[model samples]
Target: MTANENNTNGYLVGTTLERMLKAGHFAVTGELGSPQSAHGEEIRAKAALLKGYADGVNLTDNQTAIVRISSIAAGAILVQEGLEPIIQMTCRDRNRLAIQADLLGAYALGMRNLLCLTGDHQIFGNHPTAKHVFDIDSIQLVQMVADMRDKKVFQCGDEFKGIEPRFFVGAASAPLADPLDFRPYRLAKKINAGANFIQTQLVYDVPAFAKFMEKVREMGLHEKTSILVGVGPLKSAGMARYMKNNVPGIDVPDEIIDRMTAAGKGEPWFGKKNAEMTKEEKRARSKARREEGIQVCIDLIKELREIEGVAGVHIMAIEWEKAVKPIVEGAGLYPRPSV
Candidate 1:
């Protein structure tokens, strides 16, 4: 079906992320944090809840280099539940054959949107003891997928059927973490390497993001590929601090932190405590932080959407799926895209 008819039908058409990237207005998407364990019931329930509010849900594959269910497997489950699943495939845990086989399997199951990544090191995740796999990095992964879809055959001689996947493929980049002047160059390289779209790591500096977009425009990439800026609601000053200091490739500016600090301080709306807390107590104080975060995120999305070349926002609430609906609704985006 045509994209227009899919839009009129109230469901995203063509393919999941393909249609989303093609939306005229900025598209809004979200991720599903993998379950701590492979509890089918819990995973299923989260799928049901997030299905309504997000364009599609991204399933991480052993995210942060920790061991868990593979993203392709979890994606199959999400597809079975009638939710568009953007499978997050990383090269850290699999070789070319494993990755190719899984891609074919996902296509067979009707799951197509894929966010390819180099993945995190084994030392960073819950299972620090696990062995690492780095046979192919993300750019290589993108090229591999391009080869499969465009060529219709793997290096192993496995032939794929049906239309070439036409998978709406994306890769992760860190404009905020890299040297500011060099980000566009890096982005250009990735685009040339076969990245169809880019999902940037958490962005806190809107002006910096604007500059990055400008640089990308100068490279002429803005017109050729879709760019989705990643936004995570800062739950508190402490969490904001953590993002600034700990999250690699994510730069949280002092001004934004100050704004978050001032926005919810001592202002109890809806009868909730709103006191400033120290870093040690941020987790305990998250209730108030979350309230503040959602509002901040809604405002941020509004601002980010206004940037010249930004195609969309990727809202990642981490384990906060319940908050996604309210934030999106508060941001004036309801009846979320179903492509």
Candidate 2:
């Protein structure tokens, strides 16, 4: 049995998220990027925006290699704020012992969900010179955490000194990543390693994503783990194009980019005349684009919901937590299920 299925009386790790999914509610999860300072109030303020909107709030661990409030600390703050916090643990910075200690403390602090990530390489972060500690890859991290919860043993194969940490283990997936044909098999490894749920990279091309899910369903991975497709607002046309052209594993269709472009160009011209618009007009266009992005995300959620293997949607309104309520309600996923 996986960590999620080893509770005292029955299955379920006793987390709100695990129970929600087990009960078959189309789950909704949101991301909360911890600020770069140690301001507890900032974490509380963001949690306020996410509290009722998401079944679980993910606290990113030093996302983009930039130093921020640690996910564990922020997760504790979230627990105090009365929200379910998903602690994102990355192998990029910590060794196995450090990870185990953090997990123990995280569980003691009332965080029951964990997301295992290899993390963005340090090269992309502000501290490029900082060394990395890929002591174990993400898949192994999942196995290790699962072992602790289910077998009640440490990664060292020793019996737990006391009650073991029982986490609703989660991992990430990128359906559109390179070597596309291998993505399904790679996902199987995670499932086999004991991922209770998966949060995938943001996807804009529904048909392409559906194709990937078709393969996943063929393998019956969906039945083994809850799959939550990632969806997010584009913010601006530039943001859409940047992810499409530059970001790996993200497949933003030209139609999405075109729609974002249209949102910005509410006027009739796409030429030099557009450049002559005043700053006020520019600001108005940006606002319109953000609204359109939200609508697009809502529509995508609706579409993804119909796909057979999709258990729910993970709305990543990065730095735009305020938009989550509207997007969730827009997609008819509001009144967040109370499991």
Candidate 3:
């Protein structure tokens, strides 16, 4: 269908992200990490930085289980600044009651997009001693939120008195997660459970993701939902190696590592032994590798846009928020659509 035709159908025409995506615009969403302190200025600054470049900015919910300003508060801050915020809700820190209440509060705060997550374990954060409250997993959380929005009722089938939260529900997906063959089916379950859209884990190995998408297309899951493939800039060869070796469900091909290594060779410290290189020299090498990583992301986005079922690109420049504008422009996705 044509872009204009898709726009007129109007499944979700409220939030900028929903409008842009529904209008068949190649949508771009960026991630913003909430500060550990309740400094409202910091959140506003990040939101301002992403203003024109991204259709929406995802406010992480104590991402990695580390304590931070609440996603709902940060989202409210962004909304006040005229930026669209995707409030991420993780089940690691809250039970069903808190989750439902937060959803209601977020909607009242004018936040329209919700990204439900199953969150990292407490053991993975600074407060390992803290107890977890995984009363439900991500799938169940998505289902619950969908129920609240569509049925105007609680999980126990209790109806609401007045208004129900209107949210454009989203969920996370790790396409390269273990038992690769099952990843597609897992995604189908999320769709069945009521995910309106999906943002996947960072993707570096394109061919592997293509294979996964093939399975998804075979099942016609793509037609049932919108898929935003995750793309991010790698800082260095060392960082790439670290992610591949330590991070779960992330696949960084050997070629990308080699490319970063080759890019770093352009630095003055190329032939110098690691112990002999000065800190300045080391920093230059890291910068060169990061620049190369950005270029790689630009190319990846161009490639992903060609995939049949791929709906959009979620440019998660991680801590490098400034790089998003350049990457999006480089990939020719700039001049974001106006909703």
Best by TM-score: 2
By TM-score rank, best first, the candidates go 2, 3, 1
Candidate 3 segments whose C-alpha is farther than 4 A from its true place: 1-10, 278-280
Point to the candidate with the largest lDDT: 2
Reference-based TM-score of each model: 0.86, 0.95, 0.94
lDDT by residue (104-197, candidate 2, tens digit) is 9998888899999999999999999999999999999999999998888999999986678988999999999999999999899999999999
Q: After superposition, how far is residue 65 of candidate 2 from its true place, in Å?
A: 0.8
Better of 1 and 3 by lDDT: 3
In candidate 1, position 337 carries an lDDT of 57
Model 2 alpha-carbon drift over 4 Å, by segment: 1-9, 264-275
lDDT of each: 0.76, 0.90, 0.88
Model 3 agreement with the true structure over 1-339: per-residue lDDT tens digits? 642221324455277787887778888999998888979999888887899999889999988888999999999999999988999999999999999998889988889899989999888888999989999999999999899877878888999876778788899999999988889999999999999889999999898899899999999999888899999998888889999999999979999898887886655688688799898998887778778999989988998888889999998876688788889889998888777
**lDDT ranking, high to low:** 2, 3, 1
| Model 1 spans with C-alpha error above 4 angstroms | 1-13, 156-166, 267-285, 337-339
